[model samples]
Target: MSQLGKFITIILATSTLALTGCASKNKKSQVMVAPLGVGHGGNMGGYYGGPLVNNSDAIRNAARNIQGVVYFDFDSDAIKPEAARILDQQAQFLNSNQGARVQVAGHTDERGTREYNMSLGERRAAAVRSYLAGKGVNTANIEIISFGEEQPAATGSNEAAWSKNRRAELSY
Candidate 1:
């Protein structure tokens, strides 16, 4: 081979080696979670950093269909009667799925002080938690986190937006 050809071959080998090393390093840094269900597309469906949920698409769809998380009138922690039906469905799902764990995240609209909003969020989450616990779901399997007014589902100052922001979201 000519000198130029030898130089190009060396460069290609070095590039290939560098790419291989980087790939191996990434593999070492990765954390793996055991999946609970098969993916619909036959590929793993969970994100890398977040917690891996059981990924029962049917159960997920059912949970999504139930609307437990609700907006209350401003500065109130009362659970509406309409919201109760949704929670009842969630309670049933949890009761049936013995191995499942869930996190109830409570959020509030930006109409109050941050500290006050945090307390309000906690109250809302606790209310749901208490209701679920009352419905024979294990208290240990449920975790509650209150984000207060820090994370808004909607980003506007109007009542319409604020109403949307105040809610509890369930995640597994």
Candidate 2:
């Protein structure tokens, strides 16, 4: 065979293999060149193997990737941008897991009177709950509790402890 012909055949084989990699993983391959609506024809095709995977599985995976806790600045109940994005991911999972319910417990550093600290804690928890709700998670699926200064994540009299204590914990 001529050298140019052999090169053309080699190139065509390489192109075929590369394009094959782009095709869906389904073993039933006829759907590749099938027309639009003809893609899912019973015997001829399957959108995704045997059965549809549970969407909740994806949601659970997303939930697992995110830390369920959100921290706040000193004496602040505002959800920071970074915190908001994590909460958004949590909200997506919560919305997907229809049977899932969670508790958002608010905590505060030991600086204010019990009454004041309790109020602050509640505000923090409520702030997280409200954010999740705004992101489309059912508010009814979330329960809010205020721990005030009772539950300190890190115990100390310093800013590190204060920062650690001032946060909301999401528990399943």
Please give the CA lDDT of all the candidate structures.
Answer: 0.71, 0.73
Task: Give the least accurate 10-residue stretch of model 1, judged by summed lDDT.
Answer: 27-36
lDDT of 1 by residue, 1-172 (tens): 9999999999999999987775433432111222223242333322233543454666676666666466666887777887778888889989988777776767789888777887787777777878899999997777776667766777788998999888887776
TM-score: model 1 vs. ground truth: 0.64
Off by over 4 Å in 2: 1-65
TM per prediction:
0.64, 0.63
Pick by TM-score: which candidate is best? 1
lDDT of 2 by residue, 1-172 (tens): 9999999999999999987886557553111111112233342211233221233455555556668889999889999988898898788878778767676778789899877877788888889988998988887677777767766778789998899989987866
- RMSD, every candidate, angstroms: 13.5, 20.9
